[model samples]
Target chain A: SAVISQKPSRDICQRGTSLTIQCQVDSQVTMMFWYRQQPGQSLTLIATANQGSEATYESGFVIDKFPISRPNLTFSTLTVSNMSPEDSSIYLCSVVLPKSGQGGLGGYTFGSGTRLTVV
Target chain B: GIQVEQSPPDLILQEGANSTLRCNFSDSVNNLQWFHQNPWGQLINLFYIPSGTKQNGRLSATTVATERYSLLYISSSQTTDSGVYFCAVLINAGNNRKLIWGLGTSLAVNP
Candidate 1:
C-alpha cells in the first residue's frame, strides 16, 4: 500500500487559464491514472501515464486539453489546459498496489484529490 | 466497453438502519471494487471483492462474478457512512487494464 501526496488540495482558477496538479507516490509503480469527477457525476478516466512513454487518453479526452507527465515511477503531473467554467471538478490520481493475499493481483489506491473551481 | 449499473440512485436512513446496495455489470471482469466518496471528495476503497464475500467491521461485500453482479451491505449505519458509494469493475483491454465505474448510489444517514 503506497501513500500518494497530492499538492494544492484545492484551487480556484480563472477561465482560459491552466492548472497543473501533482502526485508523488511513496513507492514506485508502473502506471498512474488521472481521473476527473465532475459535479454530481461518476469518475471518468482522463489518461494513463507510464514512465518513459506517452500518456494514453480515454475517448472524449484529448492530450492537449489534459497533458500528463510521468517523469518517474514515483511521480506524475496532470495539467488541465485552457480551462473553462465547465472544467470545474475534482481531479484525482491513482495507483495500483499488490492485493493483500492475492499474490500477483492488485488493488487501486487514489490520491486525496484536487478540487478545482473555475470562474 | 463495459457497462455498470447500480440500483437505488439515492437512499436515506436513520443512523442505526441497515441497507444493501447492488451493482450489475454487463461483462465478465478481472476485478470488482467498492468505493466511498466522502463529503470532501476523498475516494476511499471499501473492498476488492472480485468474487465470494469479504467483511470489514460493519461493511461487507459480495461479488458473484459468474452472475455479473455485486452487493454491498451496511449494518448499523452511522452518519459517517453518509456519502456516495460506487462500484467499479476492471476489464483487460489488450495490454491495459481499465476500470469502468457505475454512477454510484448517494446515501444519507441522519441522527
Candidate 2:
C-alpha cells in the first residue's frame, strides 16, 4: 500500500484567505486526485493532478478556486483560494496504487485529510 | 458518467451483531472498492472487489459485476467499526478515467 503524508491536519482560516494543503506519497504513482468531503456528506472529486501538466478539474470545480500542482509523481499540493465559510470541509489527497501483476490500475489510497474551517 | 448508489442510508447495530452493506453501479466499471472513513477522517481501504468475493477477518465483500451490484458483510461488529462506509467505482471514458462515489452508508455500532 502507498502511504500519503498530508500536512496541516486541521486549520482555522479567516474568510477570503487562501490555504494550501500538501501531500507526499511514499512511492511514485501515475494517478493522483483531490477530493472534498463536506460536513456529513459524501466525497466529491475536485481534480486530477497531472504531473508536469495542468490538472483536470471536475464539473462544478474550476482552476481559479482550486489550483493544483503536481510537481512529480510523489508530490502534489492543492490551494483553496479566497476561502469562505461554505468552503469549510475535509480535503483529501488520493493516489491509485497499481495492483500486483496487473497493468497500472488498482484501488485508491487517501491521505488523512485536512479539516479546514473558515470563519 | 457512472452513478453509484448505496443502500440503507444509515444503520445502527449492537456490538456482536452482523450487518450487510450494498452498492450498485449504473454502468460497467473497471474496478470497485470499499472504504471505511474513520472518525478522524482517514479513509481505510476495506476491499477491492471488482468481481467475486474476498474476505479479511470478519469483513467480507462480494461483487457481481454482471449484475452491477456489490455487497459488504461485517460479522460480530465492534464499536471501532462505527463510521461511514463508502463504495467507489472506477470507470474509463475514452482516454480519461474517473472514480464515481456513492453517498455512503453511515453505520453506528454500539457497545
Candidate 3:
C-alpha cells in the first residue's frame, strides 16, 4: 500500500480568500483523484489528475474554481479559488494500489484529507 | 452517469452482533469498492470487489457484477467499528473511468 500525506489538514479562511491543499504520495502513481465531502454528505469527486495532462473535472465542477496541478506522479495540488461558505468541505486525495491476484484489481487508498472552512 | 445506492442509511448494533450493508448500482462497473470512514474522518479501504467474494478477518464482501449489487458483512461487531461505510463504482465512459459514490451507511455499535 502507498502512503499519502496531505497538508493543511484543517484550515479556516475568509470567503474571498483561497486555499491550496497538497497531496504527496510515497510512491509514484499513474493517477491521482480529488474528492470533496460536505457536512454529513457523501464523497463527491472533484477531478481526476493524470500526469502530463490537464485534470478532467466532473460535471458540476470547473477548473476555474478548483484548479488542480499534477506536476509529477508523486505529487499533486488542488486549489479552491475564490472560496465561499458553500465551498467548505473536506477534500481528499486518493490512489489505486495494484495487488497480485484477486481479479487483478487493487484497492483504493486515501489521504487523511484537508478540512476547509470558509468563514 | 451511473447511479449508486446503499441501503439502511443508518444501522445500530450491539457488541458481538452481526450486520450487513448493501450497495446497488444502476449500470455495469469495472471497479467496486467499499470504504470505511472513521470518526476522525480517515477513509479506509475495506474491500475492492468488482466481482466474486472476499473476506478479511471478521469482514467479508460479495459483489454480483451481473446483478449490479454488492454486499458487505461484518461479524462480531465492536464499538471501534462504529463509522460510515461507503460503496463506490467505476463506470467506464468513452475511455475515461469515472467513480460514482453512494451516500454511505452510518453504523453504530454499542457495547
Pick the winner on TM-score between candidates 1 and 2: 1
Kindly give the number of clashing pairs for every candidate.
0, 0, 0
Off by over 4 Å in 1: A102-106
What is the overall TM-score of model 1 with all chains considered together?
0.97
Please write out the lDDT profile of model 2 over residues A60-100, one tens digit for every residue. Answer: 99999999989999999999999999999999999887777
Candidate 3 accuracy as TM-score: 0.95
Top-TM-score candidate index:
1
Q: Which stretches of candidate 3 lie over 4 Å from their true place?
A: A101-105
| lDDT tens digits, residue span B30-67, model 2 | 98999999989899999888999988899999999999
Off by over 4 Å in 2: A101-105
DockQ, candidate no. 3? 0.77
On DockQ, the candidate that comes out on top is 3
Q: For model 3, what is the error of residue A45's alpha carbon versus the real structure, in angstroms, after optimal superposition?
A: 1.1
Model 2: lDDT of residue A100: 72
What residue pairs clash in candidate 2, if any at all? Answer: none
Best of the two (1, 3) by lDDT: 1
- In model 3, state the lDDT of residue A104: 47
Global CA lDDT computed for model 1: 0.94
Residue pairs clashing, model 3 = none
Alpha-carbon TM-score of each model against the true structure: 0.97, 0.96, 0.95
